[model samples]
Target: MKRRTRLVSIVLAAVMLLLSACNINMGESKEPAKGTDSGPKTEVGAQKVVFWHAMGGATTKVVDQLVANFNASQDKVQVEAVYQGTYDDLLSKLKASMGTNEGPSVVQMYEIGSRFMIDSKLITPMQEFIDADQWDVSQLEPNISGYYTFENQLYSMPFNSSNPILYYNKDLFKDAGLDPESPPRTFEELKIAADTISKKGKAVGANFAIYGWFMEQLFANQGAEYVNNGNGRDDLATESLVNTEAGVKVLTWWKDLIDSKAANNLGRKTDDSKKAFSAGQVAMILDSTAALKGLVDSADGKFEVGTGFLPKPEGAGEGGVIVGGASLWMMNSRPEAEQKAAWEFIKFLTSPSEQAYWHINTGYFPITTKAYEEESVKENLKKFPQFQTAIDQLHQTKLVKATQGAVMGVFPEARQIVEGAIEEVLNNKKSPQQALDDAAKEITAKIQDYNRTVK
Candidate 1:
């Protein structure tokens, strides 16, 4: 009893010290209150902030370069970026490390993971950090940041962002006697072009990666809901709305293309369909704007890549694209100094110059509006006119919950379930309506389980 009492006292003392050091009084509630502004930054000696991210391959090179620039720009702080596999892998590792002292000071979590991050209460809201410096975020494109804002407060900083776009082969278009400049803007027109291309044997009419993300975007394009409770923004989501009549239309269109052999039945991995396009086996594809740089590099001599706005469901919804990407979050469990250092790194990364460099190197769209004005960004756009399609799409987006995107704790799992349904339809194992209904049933059960834990 004496030893146990002593250990309890020690633990309480440590908790008090942590709370006081970060400017919180733990006597009030368990909720994480804001830290003090602490005035201007004072130089701290070689403080290292660990950032765990998910970027890999060529994009990882750009991430490392930005880190090098940030380190060279400052003497007081140093950032060490550690690659933690894909976004799904990163989220799993982050969850496993929560509340442990060994966790990273910062992490890059995708938009779908934001809901879990908030409920976990393991990170400082980026808005509080911004408020400390009284920084203005007016330059941030709302279409991108809107997805991260919850209850009127921004929780994470938007980093690499993009929306889906239609990528087509100009050479195929010319061969089919179709105008390369006038690609399809609606589902009806896409079929017309795909039919002509398939009949001509130039390549498979169109190819899709069987990605649930694209399916979600298709619903958003038609102003449809993927989940209930205003996409889990107004409150926690309890059921999925993705099995609706209009929602099934998306799956039907995709399934029909595969059945008609107009679109290749590429697997769930985005890379599969991308490789098909680069090899000149597919005439057109639908994928993220983040693929712009790689697509150009891979298809440099093979064919001219032409990009256009994502095709809308024939005459429906307010025609907009959902901005998708990961965001940088500062975990609040560490000392206040480390948290501040992480924020410093994030601020530097989002600056116009760094963002312009990032945009030129990787295909991911920059969140900062001023980045487009940079000479480097201008030069890149002049070299690759295909990028302007994404820029225009971003400008035309309206901030509704449908366009802002759905956020739920189980969204990652939800995506997997939807992908399975897509496979079934493509393989002719189920009808569009039957596939969606079955997926909705499974997703609804999972949502109920997830909500129970939160409550």
Candidate 2:
């Protein structure tokens, strides 16, 4: 096999100059592109680049616009975008495509897929391209970028960035005799508020996705690393530290939510809990910032949507939320021309105008700082005031390896083991301490297994 060492560079001045062409018309004259054509694209000849992603429906609409904008702006690159199902499905297909030589030139990689992608050795770091071109990355969000940085280098281009935030129903709050404007900011306050809602019977107090993602958020919020070796940013992780003081406290607190009937326990299925929020079955919920648009559409004007940052543990301060969502990874083992063209398309996608357009259409956090100042973003924020909650969460986050999350090769597997423990606690089958201890052992073995293979 041959190694492709060539990487493309971008001129910041020229990229800024291209901003005018990237200006997204709130309503473009041409009909917006659909699934697959989203931020990922495909086309025939003329330096074709096939983009595979895991976005559909509403998200797809915005992706189409981005791809259309990029393809229309240049003649040398004809990009074809395809929707490849959920992130898991995309990862599976991507892994399977390794031997096919006909794989996509670019792919949308979920943040959790970071280690697997790097281990697969099929990707070319976005840093290489930036360094090759001497492009300034000052515009990228630092905390968000931290999630992808490993061994002092960025591994992918952050895209569709999001983080967990508290979503509450204003109508339910008012009905429960609570102030809709003042949401809970700490665990004690959250319990009080939920207790009020539960007793008032306006709605089920709240619902939680019985998953490890929020656990990771809670750990980060209190400045606790999910894995050893500085959460794998300093070096490869060797074990799971998810049974720490912060982790145990979070587990106990979440279990208390169910025990007190303050939170609906919907197993490990996030979508089921999401539907519960949209159906107005719960007064409050914790979910991703990217869910705002779908949630608004689902509520259908039945009630006012409200947002707030995730509640923190007592005595925790200045801690922060980690960035979720996916990023763009340029695959290697291809022609240098295609690699350059892919980088070109990626540069356009991350530009200010495109980011603002993406933010308005998809409720994703804009990667470019200047995107917030763009007219389109301003107008969208005015129209959807609730969005300010997510923006604030993004701005307030401090860069820490804990917030950036674990970077181990078995991170996905680690998440599953932790989620299983959560299931045990919620179902009254095990105590938080016991469940967490058991999960830690299993995850440790998995990590050790991986390290042995890699070594």
Candidate 3:
């Protein structure tokens, strides 16, 4: 009990630290773009729709532009886009505003929140809108949308989808006498490459941020379940599979790199590790496809950036990545007219042209396959082919429970626990197996607590 209490305290501290750095003013709204016209005057009696989103930094600008375009393209709906802080903050605020007018007509939530959103019964599933309009969901990328679909029903509209890929410094690989074209495909090969690079004095061989999301992706890539009961897809999960053989192998490989001095322990912030890679401090790193643009730009004139599939253990089979990103969900408590207006805005934001602009500006996938056909998308792809790796990896992923991803009401806390376990292993405070065993047990208890309350 003392150990569990300590873990919870650590997790809460981590959450507070992250929230302090990321949370923003809830009243923030986008400024109108300069040199852009508002297209047409809004129709009198236009339905007002409020949209709450968690987009931050430059991506927030793109989201604002998308909303601006949507409002200008039509006169019947006046949609107001508001920045609602980080994903954690947004969800918490939504809960606080339940049954109140302060809540939004539509909200963008992180992917892991699906189970909680569904169980809350506060959302109007996107499936209903699709069915009402006879909308063709087949147009969207199935692998990307697969994560939001539960019980054969899509609970939300996929947006800004991404997955992890291996980013390496080609110049470092060349300096280490390795082929720049062929990246390490398996765990053993990656370790060897890292050692070679370190031994050659080119750069630290690698540094994977101790991110829990990466842990989940690694488990899926090995066809391993992060939790039991079919990765929480078939039913509510009763246990975690974090201590499975696949989990141990992955952690062992990660620790091997650090132990041999081939990889540096850059801690939990992925951005710090990314900076290390861009500054030539590391030869390789694992990051989201959404970082492609920034990475390529940062490495400009320094080194050629190379991207590869997320490496797996030797002989692992039939595994692939789960989509990672946020999705749009409609609020059921809103009036029918507001709900319909929000649906129009959703469709407009996901249109081919908008998605192309989004794809080029942000490294997120277009979600709609047709977005690839846009001229801007084609030109962007031609300019930076590394982006193709993310798309290809997504398309190649097999749609299954493991890849579909685990769902749970307590996912946010569970992630912190898993990350803590990883930290314990990397710090040599606990063996990999022991750390995972503890995390799985702790998470299962949290799940049980959550299950009891929700029931």
Candidate 4:
């Protein structure tokens, strides 16, 4: 018995030593990421590239189809597509794999993660490949390309881009005696419409989820900045502007809907609000353009859906929605051959035919203007005219500082802080001004921490 106990202790000590050497804890596993796949039997000597993405649900099928098509189209490269859970989860795994061979050759990151990805020095800028290949970037949509461009260079290739828009039930609008053809365009107008709809008792006026992305969009819609220093374009941001007048106005208006019984406090899960809207429990809701197809299909026979621009405060000017989707980034840690192969896949994915297929199957806007000329996209537009609103909004937007959106290394954390602040206001725990001020202080500290390390 003594010898057995001693043997067990020896094994435990050896395990601890191994863990320390690997820089991992017992609580963590070195397993392959979820949804990882070994590429379909590749041709001999084919370059193998691994792609990490956060897309799930039916979208995974589309990604797989695209990969299959790419693989079949060429014999030089075979790519394996992996789903790495949420954006936060994928980023965590990448951080863990830093300086190791476990990192992917290509990864999809959300738009707000641009600053962090750039600062990490882990990505090969898309501009490098574009210059090497002499590709014509002029074919891309200006508004979409402009979002990923910084310091006069494109960092990543835009994919699955979208922005928030107002969705309402046309049938409910008629029942409330509101104009079904014209959805509300301003905060005051939206409020009145909501009240009228609620008074009829058919449904609540609106149920905008307490999402920080929406708050950021609202600020941009009012030509307001979420952060200073040219929205972190000209220089690294050192302060947050969440407590500005525009911020206060947004929270006040959002809270007023609940207070006046025109809208419900549905918490922060957008899916919950989306489900309610589809069920006719709510007359209006704000959601990503990417959700348009799902929402319309869900409401097929139940109700007629209508789309409108994101509402802003009265007298606000020269503002528009920021691009609200993810982009494909090539990693510098990959081998030259693998990186080149990944670039080819990126180009193929953004081609007119693929972009049109993506745009029609999913509700995301195509990043390239030429995709609109594709027969599939034209037929899709005819089938669902609501989609044209998103396209028109993107083109009409003035590419200014506010509409360009903010960039910060700590954006993901800052968004969570802002969401918490919104909760405080909605729950009557803090006034909008006070909640925003507190949230701003928290976000500023995080930005300072991130800046220190990057600098």
- Candidate no. 1 TM-score: 0.89
lDDT of 4 by residue, 1-455 (tens): 99999999999999889988997644432433434432322445577888999988999899888899999998888899999999999989888988987889999999999998999998999999999999999988888888899988999999979999999999999999999999999999999999999999999999999899999999999999889999999999999999999999999999999999999989999999999999999999999999999999999999999999999999986799999899999998777777888999999999999999889888899998899999999999999999989988898899888888999999999999999999999999999999999999999999999999988
Most lDDT-accurate candidate: 4
lDDT of 3 by residue, 53-129 (tens): 99999989998899888878878888888998999999999999998756888999999898899989999999999
Give stretches of model 2 more than 4 Å off.
Answer: 1-45
Sorted on lDDT, highest at the top, how do the candidates line up? 4, 3, 1, 2
lDDT of the structure predicted as candidate 1: 0.87
User: Clashing residue pairs in candidate 4, if any?
Assistant: none
Better of 2 and 4 by TM-score: 4
| RMSD list, candidates in order | 8.6, 12.5, 14.6, 8.3
Error of 4 at 337 (Å): 1.4
lDDT of 4: 0.92
- Pull out the clashing pairs in model 1: none
Report the poorest 10 consecutive residues by lDDT, candidate 1.
36-45
Clashing pairs in 3: none
Every model's TM-score = 0.89, 0.88, 0.90, 0.91
